[model samples]
Target chain A: MKFKTFAMFVGPSVFLMLLFIAFPLVSVLLNSFQVTQPVFTTQEVETCSAGFLTQNCVTEVKTIPVLDENGDTVTTTEWVGFSSYANVLGGQRFVDAITSFDLGALLRIDFWRALRFTLTFTLITLPLVLGLGLAIAVVVNNATKAIKGPVIFVSLLPFIITPVIGGLSIRWLFYGDGIVTVWLEALFNTDLSIAANGWAIEFLMMFYRVWHVAPFAFVIFYAGLQTVNQDTLESAVIDGASRWERLRYVVIPHLMPLIVFITLIHLMDAYRAFEEVIAFSSESYRITLQYLTYDYLTPDDAGNRAISSASASAMLTMVGVVILLAAPLRRTWQEHRGR
Target chain B: MSDASLPRAMRQPLSLKLASNAFLLVWLLLAAFPLVWILAMSFKSPVDAFSSSAWEVLTGPRTLSDGNGVSIVDIVLGIALAWLAIKAATKLLMPMTVAEGTLHRIFNWAVVALGFGTLFVIGFFFFLPLVAAPLEGLLGPLGQPILGITTEHYQAVWVENAFYENFRNSLIVTVGVVTVSLTVGTLAGYGLARSGSTLAFWILIIALVFRALPHSVLVAGYLPVFINSAEILSPILGENAPTLYGQPLAVIAVLVSINQPFTIWMLRSFFQNIPVDLDESARVDGCTHFQAFRWVIMPVMWPGVITTGLFSFLLAYNDFLVTSLLLDASNQTMVPAIAGYFNRETTTTDQVEAVAAAVSITAPLFLLVMIFQRQIVSGLTAGAVKG
Candidate 1:
């Protein structure tokens, strides 16, 4: 195709990406290194009628760069290098906490707290989501055909709801005197509030993440299951291989690429976990990197936002995500090239 | 223990089957029960839903209520029973072949009608009343407890909270996101398919990077532009131009960009698979480039386009991140607005209404899946595995 034809086809996307994605991307990098605040400048003015009585009556009145607040002159946006990053990432505080070896003190910082949970949530749920998805897919594939459609439909319902609503539903089930809690207490003959304890809350969130995301992997794997070479399966059966051996030797290898694909998608998504934190109301005890960025942007008293810090945090989160993505992406690229 | 088995119990080793059943059962509960529970809870009165009686809402019996100072219960039940009895009589004759004679065919049709009619009668009089009216009796309509059902919370959410406005906002924003993403992404996908330029290849790769980048990082970037949109546009539109911030248009713009990577990924191969000779021949026949594309390529691209469009619609429809952050109160979509009902600042009494709102927000999603389940299942792995 001619470049002009290409432009007609590709130009709009480039312009959109440039305007929306690329521009914001560059802005984030820039904002990470800068800060904006109300600008002000000092001006000298003569006292009302004192100038008539006394020569040389000059008093300083704070004048705003654009607008004044409470008669105090506010300044325009100013560039500050790395200060916002330091505040959010806890430059000195992080180092001090590390050297002192105090886990509680380290987690006392919002960024650290969020980072800890984000990492734990991602790493822990990755295996569970993959394992559960693969298990269900393989079993369903193995099951009698009559029950498959209903099973798939029911299994997919959790993922069908958006994560927030899914999280909320689970949250209510674990909330004060909730049915689940009520049953547990009744069965165990002891009182317990799953939502009240940090560990319990984290476990529930992890479980919810797995429940909501596993069906996606299951769909991918189930689709993959159909493509498994029946000829190879027959050979394995002739070799007197058990089901476990067939799965271990034959099925897994075929599904390897799909497993990687699911992992990549899950890693990218899990690293940015936000909706669960909001849905479960877990911010006080647990937060994720994405929610930390939101917390920064949430307007504080007097309507001042932590935009600068949010910018720094966003860029930092992107850097972390890119690192996580690099390996799987490279593998995909290599696999694509081979194909 | 040997492969031959120590006994009949151990003959073939039932462990995997047992394990599979247990595993499947656990996931079924994990995956399906919460939504079912929520649906069950949404119908209960706010008092019963949150109170210790919450469990009763599911197990308790229900009954039809009086209407306009008169009970229509007896009439409805009489009709339902008659239909059901006819259906039961037909069940015994279900094995009869319709091809045998007119009598058999009539019996078959009667069975079908009675079966369906019984269901409709029971649902209309018993279930619909529970969802749409006030109820009071010794036994609530369906032979359940007197306080088994209520429609007040659904009313509080739909009518009192004006959720329809939020629904309208979601529709507007989702439509915009779908349209813009499809249009621009399809164009770019076509380009990528035909060009084979190293530049185009790199662009696709770069877009994948953007795709994986979380929305918050991007939200941080968009904040400045939105806050200063009016300032930026004053010189261009000559003043009084509405800022893009807080507009459904802005949310759509961001969503379209955010969803483009996947769209391009989906459509590019579809575009490439089209016989290039068709486009070439059309061009050779003196068709303009754009004309050839419009006349030739688009007609053949409908299936892929439809698949891509459904996904785009879903991306915009299901998104909570960009919409939650970018849109102001009046601009909030259904997902965010549903969450807004549960904002910590809201009172405890609104909890039932919040759940009702969740049910309302999710009802369309549930319906969409039921209607288009095949398309969605196929679309989920559209990019993951190459055909």
Candidate 2:
């Protein structure tokens, strides 16, 4: 009776998720293998052929041999093997797209450059965000109510503002007519253009990303800090441990699981950096996989489907690798918690 | 602890407490600087704002140059005389402290009064330019008449001058996406929680991992599928493919895919908190599983449902990337719409208008947060701490 009741309770939800979320994903996976059918009709094809051969023949081709209701087709053809997968892997359009980018001498220089930029951006921002977030969390956690209430709200304000607003505000700060530019020009008695250089652009990008994402890390870390037993910290302090010593011996070890969780989450998010970068810079600095994918799938491009699929495939492979590496960390984490 | 043993305020070792306060102050300044600067800038005239010296900009210049190469200095001298008069008046009226008996209580009251007074004065000064300029423009004989008291900048948004259609489109898309994603997410979350097993646990983890995948990758993967199938699905949709592309459904579909994982995970956590004993008791009372869930668990999980709904709503409303990518040019969200206002060729009025639009776009989210601030903070912190 209990088993029957349990099944009934869980049934609808399980069924709906499988149908909508899981099914569409699986369908995409399957469709990626199959060559998509061309939308053009037989008469359209015959008219093109007739233009080359004989003009009068185009009119006679009204009922030009075409696919019937069943699978029989005199004109329409379906190719169904590993052809779709093979075409993607062959790097035909992929090679052309990479070579067209013309970054430097290397054959896949664009892809490599994007990869390099993404990794550096992630590395630079992740530590700063986590460090600042942890510090803010600890401070806010210990503050008096008078200070804490307002401080908590202010700390969390950036997270509430959409990234577009955050990015626009930063852009305004650095623009030629902006306050920062005006202030800098006056202070130094010289013109400075941070946007013109690659390093500065990447730095600004990282700063904006960190500004928007740090609040997330702060909230998570704050919550994790709350879970740490006060007794452990008190005991450590009574034993004559310094603040840094207590942090190292007690808090760090306790927050390790959460740190790992947030790091992995942020790493994945950073890799997919799209909107902020797009808003910050023009095409010259568009060197991320997400931008590459956007460039490929843009409506004007005819070969969008193939190149975008290849890029998506590349992203999936990278994510798979990250997950594989984190597997052991996750295992040890679960084991530690179990103990 | 002895009073002598206790560290004196002046001689106390530079403790973490002191360092933390300093650190938090710096961070708070960093966070608040742009907001305060922009608010100040909104009040300053364009010429004064572009001035080279911060001292001159913060305090009006001692002398002014007209574009015609004329100088004006008496205005500065008159302002200085007025400042002296005001200072003398303040010194005469303001008391140092109240008397010491019941006057001690009066001293505290005086301090509070002074603090509030200072805030009121500063706020009035900050907003005075924004208020006075428009009024002066309207009242002047030669100047073009304007209707509003504040800057005409906000007219673009209030009137929906540029992207009014886009604003409506965003609202429709946000509402549709939130409604669908929350409904599906809630059900999926309940399922995962009730059917607890190793496989169920693994699936939950997979959902979370999928949620963690970069939004761009998911969009990339989903685009080919959505675009190609649009024509095929058009008949079912009762519209043409292009018509559907920028419509609310497209945004809703993408949001549903992206947000389902979060909805499920949050719901599962909420469900797990419900005791198995309740389910067993329901079964013993001859209620079917569906009836037990509907009658028992659903009421208890209402808060979780609402929290999930609000989160999904905010995600949909605030999203810029997916909406920008999938939605058509005509179907811009508020974020993108306001962004477009700034990207336009800026006139003095237009620039102000852009700032107004930005403030308007963010105002709703701010109001929502203020109203449900407690629920949201708890909901956000719950996932991190409990999960």
The DockQ scores of all candidates, in the order shown, are: 0.47, 0.29
Please write out the lDDT profile of model 2 over residues B62-127, one tens digit for every residue.
222322111122223335545764574357434544445433744665685567557555645454
What is the C-alpha RMSD, rounded to one decimal, of candidate 2?
Answer: 10.8
lDDT per residue as tens, model 2, A100-138: 764453324455556667778878899998998898888
TM-score of chain A of each: 0.88, 0.70
Clashing pairs in 2: none
Please report how far candidate 2 places residue B10 from its true position, in Å: 19
lDDT of 2 at A76: 25
| Native interface contact recovery, all models | 0.66, 0.27
- TM for candidate 2 is 0.73
Candidate 1 lDDT over B342-386, as tens digits, reads: 774355458878888888878878866765677777778777877
What shift in Å separates residue B79 of candidate 2 from its native position after superposition? 25
